[model samples]
Target chain A: MTGLRLAAVLLAVFAASFALAQGDPRRSGYREMGPALQKMQDDDAANPAMLFVQAGAAAWAEKAAAGKSCADCHGDATASMKGVAARYPAFSAEAGKPIDLEGRINLCRTTHQQAEALAPESDGLLALSAYVALQSRGQPIAPPDDARLSNLRAEGAELYKRRQGQLNLSCANCHDDHAGRKLAGATIPQGHPTGYPIYRLEWQALGSLKRRLRNCVIGMRAEPWSYDAADYLALESFLMQRAKGMAMDAPGVRP
Target chain B: MSRALAALLLLLPGAAVAQQDSMPSLTGKPGDPARGRAIVANRTVGLCLLCHGAPIPEERFQGNLAPSLAGAGSRATPDQLRLRVADAARLNPDTIMPPYYRVDGLTRVARSFQGKTILTAEQIEDVVAYLASLKD
Candidate 1:
């Protein structure tokens, strides 16, 4: 009887130790999932950038400032706006530079939509641009290679290669050189703008290409610039040009 | 230097803790071997052909990115294999694997796949069993 009690106590001690070793008492679940689970959960939504598409779809018809809807001017995106965004980041003669989707949307709103210039990083602007770009999903991106775009691309490429910040590292270090290596918890997707504005679960909202780039810089522990800054826009131009043949998946879902 | 030795010591425990060898073994086959084989070929059940190759006589269209799971039985432990079947990302952490199990806490599943998991728990158990049944 005493030996049986001792065996029972030993088994209990071993079980308790095992339970303690696998911490997070309840394991909180997928709701508060560890990063691995979170990444797994994002696969479908992230790859196709589906949430961005849905959000963009909604933003297309919804009226915004000055009581004007994007639909009020552009009509049905599928019909009227087909192949429109695929031709960006185009050379804008007026701006004398390559203008990406965000700048183009602001230009349209100011000229025809009778709306105010959307403040960079504003939800309204992101939604509007995302809505506009979703129309070009699956279209082969056709970024301009004319003199204007060429100049911007050069500048952007220069910026990407330039060593920046405390780490004195260039974007080339991780994105260009080490495209497929692991970075802590996530696979380093080859930085591409074929999908934006994306709905990222981390942000729990739709965001733009510029937002994604700024986050990358911030992740590198560097000082990031404002949304749609010229430097960032030029960098975007370079990426769109590089990933030209890949099908567009604007307004994508991302982890 | 002591720092290098300390780093090696720290890594030694992680290797021991990984338990790479103690994976669970599949109990008596829980699924029909034929059904599991068909599942591996079917898009709905296996879709394994999308990323892997098989020894089955005929069929093509297998991508070459990932290693062939043809003889996965000898490669990994069953518990670790279960984690991969549940969600490859759960095991690899950086993989692009679809979560075959609803092991990752998901709520309000994505649109196109709103009502279903990539593979049901039963399906995963069966597939693992079938894979375990395979020999080199």
Candidate 2:
């Protein structure tokens, strides 16, 4: 074959491989977790994350600075919050960007409750997030379809594929290329964000989805973005969209 | 240096380590294949078996994402293999293999590991030496 034809063929092969790498069907991290952890997630009474869920229920009722609680504005969380977590990391016209469940909770804390914004990964924030997400349990994830979210989602997709850190690993490297493969004795999951405020046995505490993202980046030997960074919000949006049809499994247990 | 001395160099904080960019070729004495073999088999260290199916039959759960390391010496030259192990990004921009030496352009590094490379210079040489010895 001529040099030009060979180059063309090589380019096509490269493009095909790249597309194949990105086109893997999504699967939940739940399926990738160990059986012992799966049992913990199935039983609310046995799950340690339930403590935060209970705390969040209390926080929902306790009055904030303006003599109002989350219960005051949205009464009967069971009725109001069902399937709510499935639609978060959404575009906020008020903020002019995508906001995750933690972002929305802080927004309400300051705007509606007249209270201070909770710190990222704080007990109060994790509890509240866990409680809210628990309500969406069994609901299929369905991130918003606003035209405004298109740009943010695109940015997120880029970040997910972009290689970073000294290790030079991207989200796709582990979650996409090696999903179901072993790494340091643990199965590398597809990394769908079907659960947040998950009860990771390794952490021994409830953590937001952003916290988990930060941990992965750190494992790659890369610097992690701070809490509420736009990059994180974009990634969260992308992950939620990836898991769009998967059942919500917040207060999830993982080893 | 003895194996104990190499272990001491890794354990000692701020041990006059060479930065990733400064050293291009493998530095220090010729790599000891025995030490390299141990590092490659170690899960917490080289993590080679995590992704590549090396010739270590004793290790379970070997991965298949990358090519097997059996008879790797005949497949590529020592320098080519060294670069590939140090940082395969130069060969394939999207490879999942972590750079064993290069340190810049990373994000979210931990407080204690700001300037440290994943594998020490000696460890990299050892791993390379071990790969070079894999005749079959």
Candidate 3:
């Protein structure tokens, strides 16, 4: 009974903050909203995810381990790559495991490119995978309609809702409960993936959507996924889909 | 924390130069680039040299985050630079640069210095003046 009351009080405080954020004048949004919205309706390249596409083009064209190219195996990405990035974080029957974009890309690198997989968080891996994610920018994120993904989504939601860290926060705590409220003197933006693989000034580099998610988890003081694995991407898929229509902010700048 | 950090950061310029007080007050004084250079070198209060590669007079412990401010007087207007310095994250929310002025709600620093300056408004203006003094 005591615990329930505490939960109720906390929920009310969080709700108060949420109520305050509605149409608050202090909430500064991205500067490129007008042009950004226009482009989202037009060229696929204009999609912020296109930064990854550009990066993908470069990675695909660069000479590889076999003195061949990803383009050599799959030419003119427009047709061959269309909708490929959409159904990612999919399950792989061969490995008897689920896989994300990076996983699928690395799988091809080993089988087709005859190359070693890039270690997670390494520049080549992130850049290459980010490039690939761009191809499916406008497509609805439909993780291969499978039982595996359903299970992963449930697990991910549990992880998001669990409280962690000295701050006693969860991913949902600030994002879902008190999103847009002032915290530690800064307004908390709605935690969304509309803009990602963004250039974070704090990090001084372009980072993947997963990297941002991991940073949030770390901020929550929970043990983050040590590897850029399939499980995490499934969670990323769930989160990003929830934030659909929010806009892809690839190559974006964030606090 | 703010008071101690401010004093410590200010002491840096004195440590870099052979003579103390040779570098005049950071504020007031028509904003000298030469003095700004020294402050940057000292990695003290102005610590501008720490993150940028200007006419670096001494050390290189500066961060690689921000671009060099050399010839910034001619490149970007003083107002633009002023806004960037006031709160770089406001301009580029992701910037690692600290706002030398404008302490609306900083909570980490000492209680005695709660509303105190992070490089006074005058000092920030002077830093702008000093930066603007450097041309071509």
Maximum-lDDT candidate: 2
lDDT assessment of candidate 2: 0.83
Candidate achieving the largest TM-score: 2
Candidate 1 reaches a DockQ of 0.01
TM-score of each: 0.51, 0.80, 0.50
| Candidate 2 lDDT, A1-255, residue by residue in tens | 699999999999999988965684666889787788888889988999999999999999999999999999999999999999999978778776778888899999998889999999999999999999999999999988888888888899999998877667889888888888777457888888887888888888778888899998887767788785888888888888888878898879877
lDDT of 1 by residue, A30-76 (tens): 22335664464346544434544566678778776667777887788
Interface DockQ per candidate: 0.01, 0.31, 0.02
Off by over 4 Å in 2: A1-24, B1-25, B41-45, B53-64, B68-77, B103-121
Model 1 misplaced stretches (Cα beyond 4 Å)? A1-69, A94-96, B1-136
Candidates 2 and 3: which is better by TM-score?
2
C-alpha lDDT of residue A1 in model 1: 100
> How many backbone overlaps does candidate 3 show?
12
Q: What docking grade applies to model 3?
A: incorrect
**lDDT, model 2, position B33:** 84
> How much is the lDDT of residue B79 in candidate 3?
65
Q: What TM-score would chain B of candidate 2 score versus the native chain B?
A: 0.78
| Residue runs of model 3 more than 4 Å from their true location after superposition | A1-55, A228-231, A244-251, B1-136
Predicted structure 3, TM vs. truth? 0.50
